[model samples]
Target: MFYEIVTSPCYGTVEKVAIDKDSRIYEWEPLFAIKNMNGELEVIKMGCSGEVQSLEVEAGDKVIPGMVLAYIQEDILIGGSD
Candidate 1:
């Protein structure tokens, strides 16, 4: 298994945090709801299947593109490589 870092895709205020530390997550699962500078809401999704290692942001926090949001312990399949 490998570690993956989830990042913010835009400048915004974090409206909601959908997962907690140590929670299991899957690819494309909604992770955060952010209200951008334009007031448009955006859902942030996980990029891979994993257990969340830690969270770097919380509700009401301001975030910018490329900001680290969480660290995930990525899942690894046996025999077949990712």
Candidate 2:
């Protein structure tokens, strides 16, 4: 099973897959600014606000949507390892 990791639609750019010994993902930044007919400075901050959790699946690991990836629990529960 393969899980499709996707970003929210609110994100203007899609994450790019980096080909390297250590697979890294990155997203392109969009240029956004507010200006009148005449050049003027304006506040503009465009980007996604969230954390990308590290997945349990490695380079060649098979994973399903419902499969347990990683625990984000505040307290470690005993006998929780499956």
Deviation of model 1 at 18, angstroms: 0.2
Q: Which pairs in model 2 have colliding backbones?
A: none
lDDT of 2 at 22: 25
Give the residue spans of candidate 2 off by over 4 A: 1-49, 69-82
Best by lDDT: 1
Candidate 2 lDDT over 1-82, as tens digits, reads 2222332222122122222222332333221222322344222222322223443433333333244332121222258666
1-82 per-residue lDDT for model 1 (tens digits): 6999999999999999999999999999999999999999999997689999999999999999999999999998779666
Q: Rate the local accuracy (lDDT) of all candidates.
A: 0.95, 0.28
Name the lDDT value of residue 58 in candidate 1: 99
lDDT, model 2, position 73 = 16
**Worst lDDT window (10 residues) for model 2?**
9-18
- C-alpha lDDT (0 to 100) for residue 6 of candidate 2: 32
